[model samples]
Target: MQAKSRALHEFGATFLGPALHVYAEAIESSGADHLPVCLAREGWCFHRLLKRLQRDHAIDLPRDPVYLRVSRTLLFRAMLGSETITRMALGNDFSGSVLDLMRKRFGLQLHEIFSALPIELLRFNCELPKDKDTVFEWLSPHLKALTTVVSPTRRALTAYLERSGLTDPHVRPLMLDLGYSGTIQKILTHTLKRDTSGLYFIATKPGETAVGDHQALLKGVFHEGVGWRSGCTMLDRSLLFECLLTAPHGQMVDMRQKSNGEFEYFYGREAATQRHFQDLKTVFDGAIDHVIMCRRHGVTYTRGDVQDLYEVFATKPNCIPHDVWHLFNVDDDIAGNGMINPMQMFAI
Candidate 1:
């Protein structure tokens, strides 16, 4: 399926044309709100292609022209729509069995990360580890050279807790955030709950500044084998994602401040200035890209003592969360301003 999709997508430009646009134009010209069910289904390419192909053939004819040329007699283009073309192109395979096979065999990868394990939203709270050095020993193998691994370490700690019986009331969700299988969706369909909590997991995407600062909203969750996977190689960032599960409340946190530091790209203007001004957003249509992560800084842990969470990196992470939202002080303590700890980086 992946190979087929790659083949199809590489030639995707050829698949689309003015056919839909022309239909839309015609519909608007006729000014109809409701289109016939037959007409509405024309845009999708769910039909199967013939297994055999001629040495040479024209795939270039306009859809309307093809309908006309093939029919020999004059007929309204609208009258003969997608289904006829699909059936003809498919050599009368109207059952769509090929399409169903393709659809079931695979679909587009939706999440940035996928795991055989469920990405469960486990909730717990803890201070800095008393014997923190041994916390990440299990995950050291997956860690990149010179890269401090955080997620797996925290995960090792949690699993250790479970094994030692220190982690009471531990509810494992249907899907966890690590391992070979990459999505919660597949796991939910494939496995039954091993423990209570019904094998279901809940999630909300990482935190944001515009949201209210509530203790319940600010803590964290932990994930294993998940960080290096995200292309975030700096050690600190990975730790932040893990700390979200260990916060005081059932809140979730993520390292959002990585880009709040310096970045340079060569474009029309100084890309640094462009990015700096992106979050400020005074200019509507300037060089600022409306990327979803434009506002992301280093990850923040919610609910627990922020200082202890800051210590998890084995070095100081820049107090970026406080600095970005604070005013009147570049050196404010409450709003971790002007701090960038190298240890905080999970991956390079």
Candidate 2:
């Protein structure tokens, strides 16, 4: 039945122009409400990961679910209690939009010279903390004002959960992201106070000390393998694909309070950020179109099919047109990360 429906849709696209997008639209919409409210990490890579999760993992998500953009700042601040928030604020030299907001809105610039700044919130709060009392003492005075933003953000998020039906005990929404380690999921679960499950495109298991019980439930689709596996290595070596699958947005830097007593979300932005977003979206759409074209002729995508596709990309990247390649080659964090390089992973 599914195949027949898909065939008809493909037939529509062949003769018709953009009018046939309804079939693609239907495919995109099918399991959106049925599946968990997938919260993808806000980055350029997760878009490809989202495709895999939909096609391979059998998870139905809306076409570019906006709720998935729970940025690192939003998650960390929401999950951290007043104490931890205070500690991090005191222990670090705040910068960027967050710094500006804290200074202008709250008149706060609490810092310590010798103490290590809390560079990564998860690591600082969960893994390392040298002096708790000192952090508390330094930032105690400003805790109330800081929470003005964090608290409202949490309330807004809570409302979002309620609106999305994720808060329902019966619904188990999967958190999707590109993971080196599963810190974001941990903090997200802690913040939501829910037993979350996640699908990471590629990830290593967190150490025993990692936050939240969701770690055990974390599954990787294109995970780092235990031994040398040709398919896995080929997929990993496909740097263009890895770079192509990313969030077009910057990290959510701060939550701002309005005069009317509401909260607004703030994400780190650059002059070229919107342009970068548009380019990545173009690549993502092209990838999905390719998948749709293959399926049009009954060429169903299996796990092996995906592996073959990755190998093709890795070995013969020039197969992609110069225009598309230009879009995929944008300078992004995932490109600089060591994962972009090809590696020999075949076992001798």
Candidate 3:
């Protein structure tokens, strides 16, 4: 437990050092008018920590960062009203059963999926071809029918965004998240029909290309390039980071407007169960404390320094506690990837 705590503290400082510097500069240049919004799930921790830092005089901001409850599923579903489904939204090189593909990628409920897909497709558990072109070719016939089902979600999401002040033309938003791919940022830019700035911890080379036209809008504070080539191995272990840096709540899957003119958010199953809650809380608390201490002590870390710390934490056997390995049941239901254990990658 102590070893895990210490490692997480280093993790916190390494990532936070770059974040604080970038955040201060962004706020300074964007002026007091732009709002900083944290993308939810992972950004929940960042928003809370930033607020605490601001209160403690460790960081200064003109206003509090807003916690935006958004997920890839919700954003993709929302965009179905206007945009065609792309390989990026459906997961590049996706390998899953047809049912899995429809449910996960389209964010379709069981009934909607059943009605849209042919009966034969549902009867057999057919795996999708991993090739990008093959999958899209197969999906071409069903695209219009599938997208038509979720059109209402797009309308409701627009209302929700307007309510959140995201759609206000005068208010520029700085989207914050722990990043590899800037998918959320890209979707927002497309859906909102406006340019958006995304501030991430790290953006990979592949992510830059994946973001397409919105690529220029993204800035990676810590490091931006191919992970192994650049020695930012931490970027490759995003699942582990997600495990450590997630919000206490479940992932937001859907949102709807009430008759009373209010928005309601619907969340999927909790990623981390109750049994693991206390352990996660301890690690998160320690990390936040470490960031605050570093800020107060005038200590800062570089990308290289963070890389070195991550290498030790990831490669050194028994450096992480035995119980910590069990804490890797992260649910990627939104992505249709299912539950994955990050530690399994090390076994290979």
Best by TM-score: 3
Question: Residue 141 CA error for candidate 1 (Å)?
Answer: 38
List lDDT for all candidates, in order: 0.20, 0.43, 0.66
Over 294-333, each residue of candidate 2 has an lDDT whose tens digit, in order, gives: 4454444444444554555456634444333333332322
Q: Could you give candidate 3's per-residue lDDT for residues 159-183 as a string of tens digits?
A: 8777777787876777888886677
The alpha-carbon deviation from the true structure for residue 12 of candidate 2, after best TM-score superposition, in angstroms, is: 22
Models, CA RMSD each: 28.9, 10.3, 3.9
Worst 10 residues of 1 by lDDT: 65-74
lDDT (Cα, tens digit) per residue for candidate 1, span 181-286: 1222222212221221111011222221121121111111222233333632322243332221111111111111124432221111122212343222221111
| Best-to-worst ranking by lDDT | 3, 2, 1
Tell me model 1's lDDT, rounded to 2 decimals. Answer: 0.20
With candidate 2 superimposed using the best TM-score fit, by how many Å does residue 338's alpha carbon deviate from the native? 15
Query: Which residue runs does candidate 1 get wrong by more than 4 Å?
Result: 1-182, 190-202, 206-236, 239-302, 306-308, 311-348
TM-score for each prediction?
0.15, 0.54, 0.82
- Please give the lDDT score at residue 8 for candidate 2: 31
